[model samples]
Target: MHMLSRPSVLRFDWRPTIRTLPEGQFVAAIGDVHGHDHLLAAMHDAIRRELDELGPRSAAVIHLGDLIDRGPRNREALVRARAGIDGASAITLRGNHEDRLLAYLGGSPAALGPWLDAGGEGMFTQMGLDPWRISPGEFRARFGEDLARWLEATPVMHRIGQLVFVHAGIDPALPLDRQDPHTLMWTRRAWIDSPGPYPEGVAVIHGHIPRRTVDFRDRHRIDLDSGVVNWGILSGLVFHGDRMRLLQVS
Candidate 1:
């Protein structure tokens, strides 16, 4: 997943198909929070204000994952996120970090080493779930049950009208229903650099690879991840009918 230091230049014009939902429907897709709970709350407040201003309408708030890791108060952030979406019409997708955490909790040898190396240990330590002090089975029984159930139930991709929300971009080569979860959560270089969008003129709204600003690289692909854990802004793209708006919190 090597992001181009300099994106390649292309000669042809790409007129992407513009998509829209019903007149009174709205959708908001948020980027990776990565344990930054304050930013998450701020973004939510902003969204609430926007929705209120738009008048009464059926709407959904979608969270692109990576909810924990590499920042302070991982457990608290998770709790906040869960509470935020608990009784609301919202969606939370599973990120690569969530997948790896599940693998570690299940004691998969292939995932344990890499998960620890990727800051899982620090997150567990901050949450007072010391992996060295408890067996994986005990940990699973004690701490992982509820969270794992929630994560396992989360969908890898969601479609609202013509827009698709996912943790990461899909491989355009595969049918939407047949997209692999692994690739949906972890793919980078190939998916991002691919030539076009999904079939049937559906646009992909995702977050995984971070950028300093919102990426409209391909007209049909919208990247909301601005890398909040790295001191970048946490952002959300609000879709209302045929228009889109950007909401952010630093």
Candidate 2:
């Protein structure tokens, strides 16, 4: 596997909001995986190599969610994400796609239609079931129950010091504590278009909208969804004290 690395330099304008992690703490935040288990594996290997060179440190590997659907190995990706990298704590967030699955599993039969439309039918196909043919009760007995438990366990947001990690961007108008869970997992243009100072010294790390590359141009937000399902690239942002780096595996 080939890997790409680059120094992540925050611009002066972003200085007011972005803060450093605690001394000797390191965090590797991965973007939306979308069932690319091979890319996820390669990324873990790359992060392990990076950490080896960094010496002893407290570390965490945060997956920015969308761990299932749209690809062939949804269950494999979810399992690997839960296991995380060997030397770091694993933290997983909930994306809108996972929310859809959870809704259907929670008894909203209508949710399955939209979920299937959003590439979830592929997940059922990979599981050797036809999404169109399976009834909700049958699906739950086969796979939904376990998957719902996993998705339910995932938090919508995670915070370590001033770094806030969410599947999608948060509501800029509200304080972190006041944010709606829905906005944390689903907001798009409203969150993206807002020119936010982001509640003072708080920087948001998120993945929802897919892009050709990680979006690091923003002052206080980092968009790491590199369209892995389609583009064949997966990205992660590494945070060490105040310094950051971009890592990508393709």
Candidate 3:
């Protein structure tokens, strides 16, 4: 059995204007998995233990995406994510890597090179194929087809009350409905640099820009990606009503 290191709690200290989840709901939002299946499994175990302690109530596990590429065990990581943790309904958001994957698999000639350049070739290498030799069709047949379909069908964002979950940050200038899909999967500087209370009461939870720790410095957004592939640690944030806690496994 895997053990989760003791969690660090952060009480919700937002100004009176920020909204929080409804009283009984609980949510665990995980950072980019990046094909770290062992860490994913351990994280799931920790979340199960958490829900058990919380007793019966509404709860969910949201994977912030980038479940594939740049690491070993991409397929296994997807399987574990699809299977979900025992106590929570799992929601997987589509990341930029997934976007590139779909485009490449759909026969977009322009998408292949960029995808490969961004560590996408690692998946093929794991499957015992020369990354350059395998065609997209062959790769899909061996590893993607069903997974691709699932990824295509997954939402880019999910909203639960005041909290909005996305793989990357949203454009601060536009309303949620009007924001472009590409921005949701890839935006960084613009979203991070914006100053002001965004959209009144809504807080965005995302994973894209890797940091040494979960970043809570921003008042309107929370960055959960701790660069798992390079950092050797995977992070998760738990939201129960107005309170939050950080859970991690290395």
Whole-model lDDT values for every prediction: 0.75, 0.82, 0.80
Q: What is the C-alpha RMSD of each candidate to the true structure, in Å?
A: 7.4, 4.9, 4.0
> What TM-score goes with each of the models?
0.86, 0.88, 0.89
The reply for model 2, stretches above 4 Å from the true place, is 1-18, 144-147
lDDT of 1: 0.75
For model 2, state the Cα shift of residue 232 in Å: 1.7
**TM-score-based ranking:** 3, 2, 1
Q: Write the per-residue lDDT of candidate 3 for residues 1-250, one digit (tens) a residue.
A: 5554553323233233223677778888989988888888888887787788776478999999899888787878888888897767989998988888788778666787898887787777778877567677787788767877887788899998888999988887788888788999998888768754667458888999898876666778888898888877788887776667778888
Clashing pairs in 3: none
Per-candidate count of clashing residue pairs (backbone under 3 Å): 0, 0, 0
lDDT of 2: 0.82
**Cα deviation of 128 in candidate 2 (Å)?**
0.3
Instruction: Provide the lowest-lDDT 10-residue window in model 1.
Output: 6-15
Off by over 4 Å in 1: 1-18, 85-88, 107-110, 141-144
Candidate 3 deviant stretches above 4 angstroms: 1-19
What value does the lDDT take at residue 250 in candidate 2? Answer: 73
